[model samples]
Target: MNNTYITSFDYQVPIDKIPIAELRQVFIDDFSDHVDDLESPKFQNITLDEIEAVSVYQNYNPGTEVISVIEKVLTDKSDGRELDLIIDYSVVSKLENGLSIGNKIQEQLNARNALVLSVGNGGCLSFMLALKTAQAFMQANDQYKNVLLFSEDHVIGNRYNPGLNVLGDGASAILLQSETDSTMQLVDVECYNMGRLNPVLGVRHDLKGNFKYKEFENKIQPLHYKVIYDLFNKVLRNNSLKIEDIDLVLYQNMSHNDYVGLKSALQLSEDQLHYGKMKGHGHVFGSDIIINMCHSTEQGKLEKAKNIVAISSGAGFSWAVSLIKN
Candidate 1:
């Protein structure tokens, strides 16, 4: 195993200051004329109460959000630090024009000496992929010092669909270094992608085809649980550990029911899970795990924890689980 650690992380939600209620009000006002459309089952039976509970941001741009997080992380924490590589995980090729967001971030951060790259398109599993890639990079090159992984998503275009889970606009930054002195160590990572299920969710016309949203929704939850259960076992077995060895588990915040379904399927107790605040943060792509980890640390929940597991599933039918030794 190569020496790799998650030294530091920070996240930013530009519209986090706004209350969920206000966000919901805006939606109500915009879609007031189509009450029937909003009431449809396709919208997940969304109500004003549900909107007020789930976190969401209306107009923030993900590209701008990503740049802000990167600037803050480098200024406040990574000052004078040199990065060997920077990876941006996003859904689109470029936020604006033809220039990649990763390249723009690299230039703005004065990381000209570092290699810049981008991967994934609205895939929540991108963060795990980024970490895995960083680990592999460190193992292949002793000179590799630090790798910056940045991810962000904003409510854009049809993403405001009333029938989908509340999507928030935010960005998160994680710094992975070759040093072993950090508090969080990357123990192991496991990822699986089921290409056949790609059309079950997301906006890609080619991937989605003529699939009925209602039919897909009915089967998606069980698939989520099954994949998570299998990945959980695979990660534990690979690390020579068991369920009892995991002190805490974090997952991508989809909705209230999502957390409950996973907990029931996995047979995990409340003490072993951390997802209560998800209703307040909604789903911010792959940043949910990092956000949960940060909150848990702030709340002193990780004080007694030795090992933590972070799991994420993307709309592209990809699932990833990573174990961290604290």
Candidate 2:
């Protein structure tokens, strides 16, 4: 396998920030028809303080959000190497420009030479999916020396995920180099289908072609710790590293309390964890990992981080974990 290094990453969100407090009623209204099930976990004990605010794109064509950040990052692309782009394919912005998700973004970038592709079922695990595929492509295709991996979310209607974190509208662009650099090197990326668990279909279309949300899962399986520990352990074992060998752990901004089981499962110290963009952006799909990574690097925290692991679980009931040596 060819070595892949991440030289830089950038993220963008709409200027508008909607306080979670103000969005409570709208969240409840989204599932009003299903709220009558008093025993359902979706309506249970959801407090406003769990999340502070989530950034959103008012116009709602999330393809623009993905394109904006990539263009901003590529403006300084002086390396002049042929570039290939990989992005989450679920933006649902076809109505905006009548193009496929990947093609719409590629056209917006206007890079005729740049190859573009999409990853399906892109939620919290999309970044890992894209990263793994991008690195593999880099190893096989010599024409491309750098790859841009991006993720953006807005569609699927209501951003709120029931009792989970509010999905924020944002996009992240990560630049990966085929050669080693003084930045982060890809150690390994592992993803599991996890299809047995329930899928988190936020909003769905009805037979009449109208919009409606499926009844939120009466309860989500609480066995994430096992899945996480097993996968992380496998990555660490394959790489000949232990939990104590990792310098930092970045998990998605699912919710404040969601980390309890994760923290316990990983056996990590409080200081070993870095929570970035949680209160500010909430969960921005798999972008949360890249966003948190950029946030940590911007705050000068990466200097203290050597080997880091990012973990996320989402929509397709997928689990993804990546280990990087910085």
**Which candidate ranks first by lDDT, i.e. highest?**
1
Per-model TM-score versus the true fold: 0.83, 0.86
Which ten-residue region of model 2 has the weakest summed lDDT? 203-212
Residue 315 lDDT in model 2?
55
Model 1 per-residue lDDT tens digits across residues 97-142: 6455787677777787788877664377788888788888888888
Model 2: per-residue Cα lDDT over 122-232, one tens digit each = 456767888888877777777666777776666455555555567677777877877535467887889876554443342121212121223333223455677888899
For model 1, which pairs clash?
Answer: 43-163, 91-121, 91-122
Q: What's each prediction's clash count?
A: 3, 0
Q: How close is candidate 2 to the true structure, as a TM-score?
A: 0.86
TM-score of 1: 0.83
Among these predictions, the greatest TM-score belongs to 2
Clashes of 2: 0
Candidate 1 residue-wise lDDT at 295: 86
